[model samples]
Target chain A: MNTSENMKARLVDYIEAFNAADASRVVALFADNASVEDPVGTPLKEGKSEIETFYTYATTVGARLELMAPPRGSHGNSASISFRVHITGQDGRPAHIDVTDVMDFDAAGKILRMRAYWGADDYHVLADAS
Target chain B: MNTSENMKARLVDYIEAFNAADASRVVALFADNASVEDPVGTPLKEGKSEIETFYTYATTVGARLELMAPPRGSHGNSASISFRVHITGQDGRPAHIDVTDVMDFDAAGKILRMRAYWGADDYHVLADAS
Candidate 1:
């Protein structure tokens, strides 16, 4: 597979691992010193240990990501993925969060940096009926 | 128009001004103290003067942006746009750069923060024959 295709596959794998609540699998996709900053403007979590902790907490939230659009613009060592995250809110109702993650990869194809873009407004507490 | 539509219109206007190489028009879309980090990992250009200088240099590169996909996931005050930027390289040949810009808006609807995501590898020099 070409670089773009390879990156796309890795991206899909990362999401699948997240949906499966496999924190180890998700964390393995990153380099030893990778950094993740969810929501772009937040502080970053660096290194494998910190990344694992972040994902561990994330997986416990029972969030499932559904791709809103096919991953777009994979070039060189960078790729961007957009998806809708479904999770149960504190009120035991469904919540939807729209997120776009921009990732940069290292030579070994491990994610070196991940920046997720979304704001508080990107989240919606779905009606209980739906 | 609602918030999403308004943000989308602002995004389109930004691109249109970029394609027109009108630096003033392009910079006007941003707030006076807006911050722009093109390519995500770069040091930010903060404030109108710095932002205008960045666009000034960019516009001089003879680049035109073509939307690769409709602006996606505008919620609250954030929006993201994916596009292909065509530019004439030093070799006097066409170069295509794929870019994704995630922007945050202020209450006044001007861009408060703009983060452009793309790496050097996202650029390709088209063959003259094409």
Candidate 2:
């Protein structure tokens, strides 16, 4: 795959891993030192260790973000993508957010870093009586 | 500067450029093809030309994002940063948001890509009755 396609594929795999609760797979897209801060009661995972720990918290309480095409520009070893996030809030309300992400690549085009920006509270959280 | 410090300095410079309405300085941190999507009524500027345009919108509204230290981890050419945004909403509310950003670097530590995540609605926008 090309750089952009590979990134798209990797992002898809990340969502799949999250839905399936596969920690290892979710961690695979990152380099050994990748970090994340998901905050907003989701997954504020940082670094390889914390990222693993953060994903561990999602073993039961279901949360998923179905992603659409992102706003993006790719050049050489770097690309920025913005995507619409459509998901059912934990409480089961209709939730949506358009997220923009910028990614840097290693010489081989592997994901070196990924940053995301979105309006999380725009999501209406319903009462999760489940 | 070190990778992390260089990134921080660049981020600071970006804010300064915005405050001063210096589009050229703001566009310097990015690679020739860098992109931006500052949604939520801010700046959804993409590509070089669009980024320049987005900054143009802020010239008169007097908008600014006073950034604090971000949550971050940097090793090699990658890092994730989360920071607190304390800004006077267009309506002049005591608005605040904790934003997380992920950045990637080229082999030379030049920023190649950047992604931002924030709660814009969480931002208390004053009615800009200006």
DockQ scores of the candidates: 0.14, 0.04
- Top candidate when judged by DockQ against the true structure: 1
Model 1 segments more than 4 A misplaced: B1-27, B30-79, B82-99, B103-130
Point to the candidate with the largest TM-score.
Answer: 1
Query: Could you give candidate 2's per-residue lDDT for residues A7-86 as a string of tens digits?
Result: 55565666778778787777776766665634222344556787667666653445555544332323334444334445
Return the lDDT, model 1, position B10: 88
TM-score of 1: 0.63
lDDT per residue (tens digit) for residues A68-91 in model 1:
645644435677877788988888
Which RMSD values do the candidates have, in order? 6.1, 13.0
Worst 10 residues of 2 chain B by lDDT: B68-77
Which residue pairs in model 1 clash with each other? none
Candidate 1's displacement at residue B99, Å, is 5.9
How high is each candidate's TM-score?
0.63, 0.42
B-chain TM-scores per prediction: 0.94, 0.65
Candidate 2 iRMSD in angstroms: 12.9
Q: After aligning candidate 1 to the native by TM-score, how far in Å is the CA of B40 from where it should be?
A: 8.9
